[model samples]
Structures are given as structure tokens and as C-alpha cells.
Target: MLIGLEIKNFAIVSNLSTEWHSGMTAITGETGAGKSIAIDALSLCLGERAEASAVRPGTDKAEVSAQFDLSNLPLAHAFLEENMLNNDDNECLLRRVVCKNGRSKSYINGSPVTAAQLKELGQYLISIHGQHAHQHLLKAEHQLQLLDAYAGHHNLVNAVSQRYKQFADLQKEFKQLEQQQQQQAAQKQLLEYQVAELDEFALQADEFEQIEAEHYKLSNSQTILQVCQRELQHLYENDEQNACSILQHSAQQFTELAQYDESLASVATLLSEAAVQVEEASREVRNYTEQADLDPQRLTEVENRLSGAMDLARKHHIKPQELVGFHQTIAQELESISNNSSRLEQLEGEIEHALEDYQNASEQLSASRHQYANTLNGLISESMANLSMENGVFEIALTAQNDRAPNSLGFDNVSFLVSTNPGQPLQPLAKVASGGELSRISLAIQVIIAQKVTTPTLIFDEVDVGISGPTAAAVGKLLRQLGKSTQVICVTHLPQVASSAHQQFFVAKEIADGETFTHMLALNKDGRVNEIARLLGGDNISKTAKANAKELIKAHG
Candidate 1:
């Protein structure tokens, strides 16, 4: 519940701070006395849109701050905890400032917040019903929602919503599959030819590596043979000086010296090892030289094979190494195409099952709503009678349209129909109800739903607009009763309604020092009597009006 509101430099409200109470509180003033300015200021704090124009004529900015007692609201606590904005004290502060340069800033609990965040928080904190709210009731969709809310069918609604989403998702998948099937059909022949061409080569994973090694050998075969022959001659085949011959001569000399000294025996063993290594190197070189092929026909064969592999790689937009995996993918696609009819049949069956589930859920929801609609119509009609519409007929008309598919709300469209008089044809509430009647009807609905609402605060703006005398008194009594469970704030002009407030605020405009501003004060008993008397007698308050005001207050108490 809103505990306090502070508005600065906003329109005619230069600066104002008002404390709100826990029951019905009324803001009353003469026309053009800036009651709307007060409302606008409250709205700003409630995250309503604001602009520089709202700032007072010479002010640089307009600021609005509201304090809410959130000790009992778990949702508020959760939000605070989630945002890490929880305070030691259990109060929530919302503030907004609009600069003259068209910039705005918002804060929650002294922490900077976006307007959207503030708006989200505001939805849970307060609900303001101005004239525009009546228009919301006129929409058929909103009426359906309200009916559902009243019926407490949230779980059923959620189930239907989930099923609808599942159905939509399946339909999307089916459409995508159908498109894929069409595209695959168009490319079937080309894909088959490509696969066959690639398959004809019978390429293996290691074939590319093997071919590369062969290409290296065939490309430099002559150079390799020459290098190998030179190495062999130098190492072992030279007539005079060769590595193996020298090492053998050294080994004999060292063996002869080993008889004279032990160190000479070690040198002889090293020379023998060198001779063996040189002989091995020469044999390897000779074998390589004999095996190297410089034949142009062999080179041409290697080059053509390598070129074919590279060309195939380029055609498939893949590297040679990736060709193996590419073939695997195409093979899978070919298999899928061969079994396309079976796969499609499987998908169709799944879709049919999903559709059946959705249809069944929708039918169940529709039945529940239809059953609840009768009870709802009777309740609303009874509420209307209590609100002084004795002959009023209330109805929930369910129209089933073929074009309207099953939705979370069910398959039928709901419209609220009402007839204010017995002989009159029932029309949509929005089409026929005047402002006063709308106010009463809205009150009736609110009263019926008040028991179900968990929100602590309910604000009613001139809900008693077209009511007076006994009807106005009845509306006042109803608001008071509602206030027993929920905190209600009402802006009203009727004396009877004003008297019903547990706490009353009198809004009056004053002109001081060439500046005009509005002020509000909590009314004392005498003050309230005078104010209500003023409401009863207009500009002049007669002795009889004062007496009557006292009597009304006494009766209300």
C-alpha cells in the first residue's frame, strides 16, 4: 500500500507531500483545482509516462516519489531480493524525475532503475482505475480474461497454453520438413549423379597421403637417383678414397697397436664400428638409387591421379582430407531420400497425435468455461442488482467461430452482454453503458472479485460518479466493506462517498504571491463536516447542510 507521495514542480502542483492511510481516502476539490495534477503526480510515481511539459513553467525538472509499505507482499520481497535492492527496513521507495530537456530518470529503493523496470514493479504495487480503465472492460478479449480470472481456471488455462505451444511447434517443424522434402526432391538427380561419380573413384581415408608421397617421389626421381649414386660412391665404391675403405685401414692399424697398450684396443673397436656404419650407409644409398624411377609415363600417371583428387576436392568445396567425411554425409542423405515416404508418414502420425492432445485439452477447457459462464452470469447479475441496477441482465455470451482455432482461452469467443432495463435488448457493456453506469458496473465486478484478489491496495477514482442519494450511500458502504480486507483510495465528489472514508483529504487550490498551487490536508472532524457540507450545499454551506452532513457522518459511522 502507498504510504506517502511527494511531488515537486509538476504542473500546478509546485511541491506537495501527502500521507495516505489504509482505508478509503478521498481527494476532493473544485473543478480546475488541480485534482488531476495530483493524480498525474501519483501516476508518475507509479511509472506512468512523463514529459518535460509536466514540469512547472520555470522549473528544470519534475520529480515524484512514492513510499509503499511492502512488509506483507512476498512478491515485492522476491523482486527486491532478486535485484539485490532489499533494505533493512521493509519499505519500497519508487521515484521518478523528468527533466526539462526531455530526459527522465527512475529509481527503486534509491537505486537507479529503468522506466520499464519501474513499470513492472508498479504493476504489482498498485492498480489505478481512471476513465481509461472502462475502455479496457469494453474489449472482448479482456472480458474473457476477467471471466477466466474470476473462475480461477489458471491451471487449466496454463495447460491449454502449453498444449497450444506444443502444437504450434510441431506445425512449424512439419512445415520445415515439407520444405526440406521439396528442396531435396529438386536436387535428388544431381545429388545421385555426384554420389555415383565420387563412389566410382572408391577413395579411401589414407589414399590422399599415399598419393602425395608418390607424387613427391615421381616429381624429383632423377635428382634423388643422382644424389643417392654420389653418396654411394663417396661412402664405399670409390677406387682410392672411400669412407668404408679408410675406416677399415684405420681399424687394422689400431688392432696392431692394441697389443702394445689397452687404450689402443678401445680405438680399434671405435674404428671397426665406423667401418660397419659406412658400409650400411652405402648399401642403403645403392638400394635407393636402383629403386628411383625417372620414367615420364610413371610421372604422368602420378600427376594425373593427384590432379583428379584435387579437382574433385575443389568441385565439392572441400579439402582433399575432408572428402571422406563429405562422402559419408552424401551417403546418409541418399539413405534418407530412399526412406523419405516412411519418415514423412512417421512425422504425420506424430503431428496427428499432438493435434489430438491439443484438441482434447481445448475441449476440456471449453467445457469448464461454459459451465463456469452460467455461474458467472448469475453472480454478475446479482452484483448488478446490489449496485442498484434492479432490472439489469448480465450474460456471458459464448460464440464459436469456425475460423477461430483452439487457443489457450478455449475455442469460443466471449462477450459480456448487459441490458440496464427489462425491455431493452442486451448489448455489449461498452456499447451501452454510460460513464455513470460503467462506473457502477465496474464497481460491481470489482466487489465480486475483491474476495479473490490478494493485492493489498485498491484505488477507485470516482467510482461513485453517477450515483447519488441511496445509491451513492450504497456505493460508499460497499467501498468501506471492501476496505475491510483491502486498502482502498477513492477520489470522490459525493458527500456520502466522502463521508465513508476512514481518512479524508480535502484538496483545495490557493493563489499566493502571484502563483497558483494546489494543497491537500487531512480533514479533522469539523473540517470533514464543513467539506461534506460544502459538497452538499455547493458554494454556500447552510446550517441545514451542516446538520445534514453531521447526520450523514453519524449514519456512516
Candidate 2:
């Protein structure tokens, strides 16, 4: 249940803080006095969308915060724990801030959260019924939702919806795969031919680089031989002043001088090493000239191989090195297309199973709807009688649709049917009921549904509109009855409703320093009587009106 509310610069309210109580608390005021301001601020705390206009005329922002006692709300407690927002054992605080630039922020237990998260948690805390809630009855989808809510079998409804979604998603995938299969035959054939050509070549990784090296060496063989012969002559093969003989003579002369000085011995050793190195180098040159091949036929074979590789690379619009990876990619694509038929068969089996699951769940949901529809009809009919529609008949029509495709709402079209007058045939709510009758019926449904709701707080913001006199009193009594098990807060202009509450709050606006402010005062007995009298007789409270207000409060008390 809601324990406290604090509002700062929100709408016409400037820093209003109040603690709430259990049971039915009536909020009453003259029109334009902002009686619904409290409810509006509470809604912001519950994560409703906020706007800049919600702030006071000159304020930078608006802030609304609410404190809830979660002692009786196990669901809300679990939600806080699950979201890591739990603090202070049995209390939960929700806050919302709206800045002048239209930016909004939400907080739970002082931890920042998204507005969506706030809404998710709000569902477990309170159920608010607005003044225009009845207008939603005209929508078919809302009618179905009401029926489902009344059934109180959320698990079953959720199962049906999930199964339908799975079946539809599978059907969509199946269609897309079928379309792809139809378009892939030609593509598969073309890829097969191209892959066969590449397969015949059988290119190996890095083989092209080795081939290019071999081709370059073979093409320049003559020039390489000339250079090698010229170097050999200069180093060793030349008969006139060859390097080997020169080095040998120089080593002998240095050996002779080594006897005089030790440094000359080192120089003789270096000359001898040079002669040996030149001799070894000449042997290597002769070995290469002997082994180097100069065949034209082998050169033609290598040239043809290199040309073939280049032609294939150009045809594929890639470098020769890239052919290997490209070949693997096309081969994989071919394999996948070849396997599509098997995959298509697998999808068919899965889709058939999904459809069976959907049918079973929807069938069970339809059965449950029928089972609860009768009970709901009886309860609503009873409530309608109490709301001054003694002859009104209410029915929940659950029409099964066998041919329609599976849908999230199951295969039943739920409608609210009513007969407002005697001897009148039952017709759809929008087609048959007048504005007044619809209001009464809406209230009846809300009352019936509220019995099954487990939320600790239920707010009714002028849901008693278009009702008066005995009907207004009846509305008040019903709300009081609801307060027995749940906290009920109603904002109304009806004196009877105000008198019916365990606590009364009178809202009135005052002007001070050229600014208007709305105040909500929790009325004591005398204050309650005066507020009720004002409601009964407007701004001028006559003696007769005060007497009547007192009598009404006494009777209800």
C-alpha cells in the first residue's frame, strides 16, 4: 500500500508532502481545484511518461516521489529484490523527475532506472483506474484483455500466446527458405561449372611463387652464365696474373720477411688464407657452370605453366595467390545449396510440430475462456443490478474461430455483450449501450475485476462520473466495500462518495502573491462535514446543506 507522497514544483503544487492511510480515502474538491493532482503525481512516481508542462510555471523541474509499505506485497518485494532495488527490509521508494527540457528520470530506492523498468515494477505495486477507463471498452482488443484478466489464468493465456508466436515465426522462415530454393537452382549450376574448372587446375598454396622464381631464373640463364664466367676468370681461371698465383707469391715474400719481425708473420698468414679462399671460390664457380641447365624445351614447359596460371587469375579477377581461398568459398557455397533440400525437409517437420503445439494450447485456452465466461457473466450481471441497472443483462461472448490463423490472443474473439432495457436483445457494448449505461457497465466490470486483483492499492479517478443520487451513493458503498481487503483511493466531486470514505481529503486552490496553489487537507470530523456541505451546496453552504452533510456522514460512519 502507498504510505507517503511528496511533490515538489509539480503542476500547481509547490512542495506538498503528505502521508497516506489504508481503507478508502476520498479526495473531493470543486472543479479546477486540482483534485486529481495527487493521483497525477502518484502516477509519475509509478513511471508514467512525464512532460515539461507538468512542472510549475517558473520551476526548473518537477519531482514526485512515493513511499510504499511492501509488508503485504510479496510480489513487489520480490520484484525489488530481483532488480537489486530493495532497501530497508519492507519499504520501497519510487521517484520521478521531469526537467524543463522534457528529459525524464526514474529512481527506485535511490537507484537510477529506466522508465520501462519503473513501469514493470509499478505493475506489482498499484492498479490505477482512470476516469476515461470506460472509453477503452469500445476496443475489441481491450475487451479480450478484460476477459483474460477476469479469468485469472495468466499462465494458460501466456502459453497460448507463446505457442502462436513460435508457429508464426517458423512459418515465416519456411516461406523464405522455399523462395530461396526456387531461386538457387540456376545459381548452383553456374557455381558447379566454375568450381570444376578451378578444380581441374588443382592449384597448390605457394606453388605459384616457386614457379615464378624458377621461370625468372630459367629465362635469364644465358646472362647469368656470362657473368659467372667473367667473375671466374678474374678470380682464378685467367692465365695472365691470376689471383691465386699472385697471392701465393705474396705469401712467400712475406714469409721471408717474417724472420725479421713478428708482424710480418701475421701478414704472411693472411696472404696464405686469401690464396686458399680464392682456390675454393674458383671450384664453386666451375661446379655451378657444370650443373646449370640451358634447355629450350624445359623453358617452354615452365612458360606455358606460368601463362596458364596468369590466365586463370585474370579470368577470376584476382591475384594468383588468392585463387585458393576463392576456390574454398565457392565450394562451400555449392555444398550449402546442395544441402538445402534436407534443411527444407527439416523445417517442414519443425513447422508441423509447432502448429500442433499452437493448436493444443489455443484449444485449452478456448476451453478455459468458456468455463470462466459464464461465471464472469453472472458476477457482472449481479454488479449491474446493484448499480441501478436492475433489468440490465451482461454477457461475455467467446466466439471460437476455427479457420483463422493462430494469433497471439488465441483463436477466440471475445466481445462484451449487453442488454440495457427489458425486452431488448443482447448486442455489442458499443452498438447498444448509451453513455450512461456504458458508464454503469464499466463500473460494474471494474468492481467485479477488482475483487480478483491482488494489488494492495487501487486508485479510482472519478470513475463514478455520469452517476448521481442513489447511484452515486451505491458507487461509494461499493468502493468502501472494496476497501475492506484493499486500499482504495477515489477522487470525486460527489458528497455521498466523500461521506462514505474512512478518511476525507478536501482539495482547494488559493491565490497568494499573484500565484495560484493547490492544497490537499486531510479533514477531521468537523472539517469533513463542512467539505461535504460545500460539495452538497456549492460555495454557499446553507444550514439545510450542513444538516444533510452531517446526517449523511453519520449514516455512513
Each candidate structure's TM-score, on Cα atoms with residue i matched to residue i, is 0.80, 0.83
Candidate 1 TM-score to native: 0.80
- lDDT of every predicted structure (CA atoms): 0.82, 0.90
RMSD of each: 4.8, 4.3
Tens-place lDDT per residue, model 2, 1-557, is: 89899999999999898888999999998899999999999888888888889999998999999998888777887888898888977888899999998899999999999998888989988899998988998788998888888888899999998998898898888888788888998999999998999899877888788888999999999999999899999889889978998999999999999888878999999999999999999999989998998999989988988888888899989998888888899999998987888888998999989988988898899899899889989998888888899998999898888778888888898889999889999999999988877887898898778888788899999988888998888888988999988899999989888899999888889999999999988899999999999989988999999999999889876
| Tens-digit lDDT track of model 1 for 206-226 | 888898899898888778788
| Clash number by candidate, in order | 0, 0
Task: After superposing candidate 2 on the true structure, give the runs of residues whose Cα lies further than 4 Å from its correct spot.
Answer: 175-189, 210-304, 337-342
